[model samples]
Target: MINGISIYEILTLTTILFFIGVYGFFTRKNLITILMSIELILNASAINFVIINTYLYPENLQGAIFSVFIIAVAAAETALAVAIIINLYKMITSVEVKGTELMKY
Candidate 1:
């Protein structure tokens, strides 16, 4: 246990966050909402990495390093995704998933 919270409890929270992110990703139509859900999913995984690493290897910082890397990658991914979404929205005037299908040509 860390900070008075058991590993099971922490893992449970991460699981809930992961599922919420997954649900949002599948059900949301707007590009921005989908992007947010992706971020949530990424964040949950990062937290899981940190917590599990800390619990299993109290002396090692591998999990912390990985979480940092994940965050950096996620930021870059978000920047690129937002740019693409913005261009798509400009061309179609809609950010819905169906609207992007018109760009398939």
Candidate 2:
């Protein structure tokens, strides 16, 4: 237990968050909502990494380093995704996922 919270509890919460992200990603039709869901999934994994590291290897920095790397990658992914969405918006004027299937140059 760390700070009165058990690892099981933390893991459970992360699992729930991950499923929520999955659900959001699958159910949402909008591109921005899909991006938000992707962020949520990435965050859930990051949280699991940090939490496990804290409890299992308190003296090591690998978990933290990996978390930072994941964050950096996530940021870059978000930026690129937004840029794509913007360009798609300009082309189609709509951000719906199904509608984008027929996207033209």
Q: Which digits, one per residue and each the tens of the lDDT, describe model 1 over residues 1-105?
A: 468888899999999999999999999989999999999999999999999988877788889899999999999999999999989878889889988674565
What is the clash count for each candidate, in the order shown? 0, 0
Angstrom error of the Cα, residue 36, model 1: value is: 0.6
The pairs that clash in candidate 2 are none
Worst ten in a row by lDDT for model 2: 96-105
Tens digits of per-residue lDDT for model 2, 11-100: 999999999999999999999999999999999999999998998888987987899999999999999999999998898888999877
Task: Please report the TM-score between candidate 1 and the true structure.
Answer: 0.91
Cα error, residue 59 of model 1, in Å, equals 1.6
